[model samples]
Target: MSVHIAAQIKRVGRTLTANRAFLECITGVWLLTAATHHYIMAPASVLSQVATDLHITSGVAVWLVSAVPASWAVTNFALGVWIDRLGDYRMIALGVGTVILTGVWSWWAARQGVFSSLLGSRLVAGVAVGVIWTASVNLIGGAVSDINRATAIGVFITSAPAGFALGQLSTPVIASWIGWPASFLVMSGAAGLAFALITDSVRHLAIDPTTNTASMRANFTAVLQHRAVWYGCAMAFAAYSYYLFMNSWMPTYLGQRFALSAALSGGLAAVFPAMGVLSRVGSGLISDRLLGQRRVPVLQAAFLISLPLIVLIAWTRWLALIVTALIVAGFVIQLTFGVVYSYVREVVEADITGTALAFLTTAGISGAFSAPVITGALIEWTGAYLPAFTYAAVLTAIGLLLSWVAPESPHSMN
Candidate 1:
């Protein structure tokens, strides 16, 4: 019996080491996938072209971009519940396969000159993204230990903004040269490589079963009853509202308000996500260094600082002021993601961590999904960007208040 206990301890140590290595590789692939999806299929590039071809207004064209997050909101909840049962590798494999198939379909549809088929292809990609995002984050949280968890999660989540930034940087170039369809083909090939890497690395890990009906229900109930989970969800929702607004509408705002060309607007938009990637890493390091300190204050400080910057970017016409505001907003908004993830994980049990993450993701996706449609309507109604920016700013302030009110879980460094 003593020998068995000793062997189990050694095995756990080995698993921890393997998990860290696996997370490193997984984060790289995740960044690739995120950058491609955000930039290639993003509303700014693909939807703009498709809208022009279809003779639709910008308001309607925005749906193509909005559909991805909206679909993700619904699908992520289901996928989150099932990820443990399917195992991380299998789920990732399925997600990659879906991306590959959809990429080819997207390319073919673009070639066929059929707008509806292309839209269908984008929706298919959205489904895959929903599953991929949820499973990947959960996988990282499950595999890593508490001590290094925030840093690992910070690296992984930074991919979200980094991917968006890369998309902004590359989309215009790809669209101008080979055209958008060809760009997706390139992305498909990349997804294939990522799939191969993830599968190879995680093949030996244990797969948990999802068939335990009662336990699943109990887990959901427990998460629902947990205040920390709700607070995390609220924070994510507010942060995503800011992120989606920048991602979906910033280029159009530049084009409409500033009279910039698509290429130039895209270039400017790239800076926001680039700053976001850096901020994510910085915030995680801060959280790690201040572990057991007052993290809620740190979160509130970021929110309060970012609100005015976002408003300034939205309202200003000066090129220098606009650019500076965007850079600061990106840094501030993107950093909140890792902090929220760390907070939730600290509060939840390791066994049900995936479930907790799914709830937070759902809230974030809901915010992201709503931003485009609502912002489109706001623009349609007000004929100005001020109201939309104001709405986001107010939400950020509310998020700050919520952070203060939320009870810090025992898991916090404080």
Candidate 2:
């Protein structure tokens, strides 16, 4: 571990200190992405309250939870070229700006008890999120050198789990004091701060304002034809499926099985995503240092380790034991999340990173959007959680197989 840490420090060199522009670009992009996640998840904790207040069935209210990702899945693909044309900084601004706008709109809609208005706001926010997600990564990939890119991106991706955990833990607590609407307001305020950070920092970054239709067409064709990109997409789909499965259902599962309070179940489930804060960066450090920047091996190991852990999470009845499994599974399952982002970019040329990542983001978030819905449907049909979990385990097994056979990034494999 000490040797790995030293290697990381040596690779990073003066990037952290002497390169002030890179530091600011990464910091702003990280905060911008984190704020988008916070906006995406702010309502998750209060969905029950939303259902009760709006006089809607729990079934209809669940859309409030899934709506953002569902919309994100579709728009992420549609916005691929637009992301390139607008350049990273403009796209980032547009995305963060939209989140701020929609956050306020959702808050107002909730205050008025209009379910459609609130849901509409979320769908719009999802579009913005898709924009931020792709552009932020493009900015990171473009800003850092290939040698240090994985480490930098790993650090950037930590914002996701951090923001997710923050929204899950903070929203309910904030609602308890004032009201659920206040949660959206707080999220919007956070976005406002992110906007300030980004606007102040990213002025020095390069802008790729490619407006030629022919160039866009060629880039799209190049990304679509790459075989390794598809493997990376497959890994993304599986990882995201497992991620959302746990995020969406674990709290309710704990509540149903153990009779834990909503707060307690949520707090426990929060442990799952919370683990990503450390594991994402750790995976990056290990891949960059210990594995000589090899991403496929880390991905293969994560999926292989996750197979039994998923089964253990599904069947275990002991609270203490399940919590232990959750901790380990959380870290193990998400080991690929940060790595895949780096993998997809490294597999392709620098010019088309945005287009390549669009395919990856689309596939990944599609899994995220579909997982809970599919699992919920299975549980409804079978009258049990076992089948749903089995489905997730099968997906992870497929991911492991894909990682086993997938080609490694030529540049990254020393």
Candidate 3:
């Protein structure tokens, strides 16, 4: 047993700090990942705090939760290709710098107790998210070899859900002890720490080699014409829509529906992202090892399995059943995130990899927040969670139909 434990420790230690560059990249990604999530989840984690402090309903409070990803989507569309083409060290450094400045603003704005100010701070923090997130994903994807693509993408993305889980788990307790705004302060420190450690590491990353130099319009138009690219974009939109809906609204939903406290509600909601962390790695491994020639099967199964679980959440009154349903839903819903990234990389031209990524992410992030905002307004109009769950079901169905027809990547078989 001791020998086994030692071997496990050695394996983990080797992977985590394999070299200075790897260390910096993973650590920076994890911290910034945590920072983005912590920023939005502060509101989600303390939905009651926003409601009381800002004089808003739970639905209105979620607009603050949705705002970061909305801005992130816009930034992805606006800057993804440009950053991919022209960015590297300076992009990463500036991204980190933006997060630090805006993270502090988020902390302060939330503390001041105004709705618009808090929403504005979250939006600005999202720009930082778009910058850092694009740089980090590009760095990891470009650095690794094609053979290991799924594993690298999967492992790297685990950081986001991990950060989200960390925020969800800790923020409620921190908010309870130190006040809600303090969570943002702690998360800001995390982003600051990442900037300090990561800037130098990014300076050394390998540039993506490319032969295509077409005009932006031609590059985008080319990829857009491919069926696989559309599949990736469509999946991104559906997956992110369901993810953000739950993340932005579930804490408040649990609290209001179950009559639980903020801390407890956050803890319960934390189960979702926590499951996501492990499921992402598992999905990647499945793509890499079990289904090396395909990703659509994994992607399709994820959508099909998630439908009932989502409905269960909206319909069930029993806490144990709801939690169980959420855990399963979380696992199934997250599989596509890691698998499709590798899949997207396989299908798109290397020159516009970032452009394609921007396309996918914008489609995804926009899908993530757009309907939820309307869902918020819908809840105002109808005063029930059924409409949101019904919407999630339809989106998942659409994802399934798309995945069924998704073209298999040639690189995956090669």
Least well predicted 10-residue stretch by lDDT in candidate 1: 205-214
> What TM-score goes with each of the models?
0.85, 0.91, 0.84
Q: What is the per-residue lDDT of model 2 for residues 310-356, given as tens digits with 9 covering 90 to 100? A: 88888877999999989998998888986888899888766677788
Cα lDDT for residue 123, model 3?
86
Ranking by TM-score: 2, 1, 3
Each candidate's clash count: 5, 0, 0
Clashes of 1: 5
Best by lDDT: 2
Q: Candidate 3: global Cα-lDDT? A: 0.77
User: For residues 123-167, could you state the per-residue lDDT of candidate 1 as single tens digits?
Assistant: 777777777777777676566555666666778877676566555
Residue-level error in angstroms, candidate 1, position 193: 1.0
> Per-residue alpha-carbon lDDT of model 3 for 114-227, expressed as tens digits?
778878888887877877776677677776667667777788788777666666668779877988777877666887787766766655555554455567777778778777
Model 1 spans > 4 angstroms off:
1-20, 35-43, 46-48, 52-60, 176-178, 203-216, 252-266, 293-295, 314-319
lDDT of each: 0.72, 0.83, 0.77
Deviation of model 3 at 122, angstroms: 2.4
Candidate that beats the other on TM-score, 1 or 2, i.e. the better one: 2
Better of 1 and 3 by TM-score: 1
TM-score of 1: 0.85
Looking at candidate 3, the ten consecutive residues that score lowest on lDDT are: 203-212
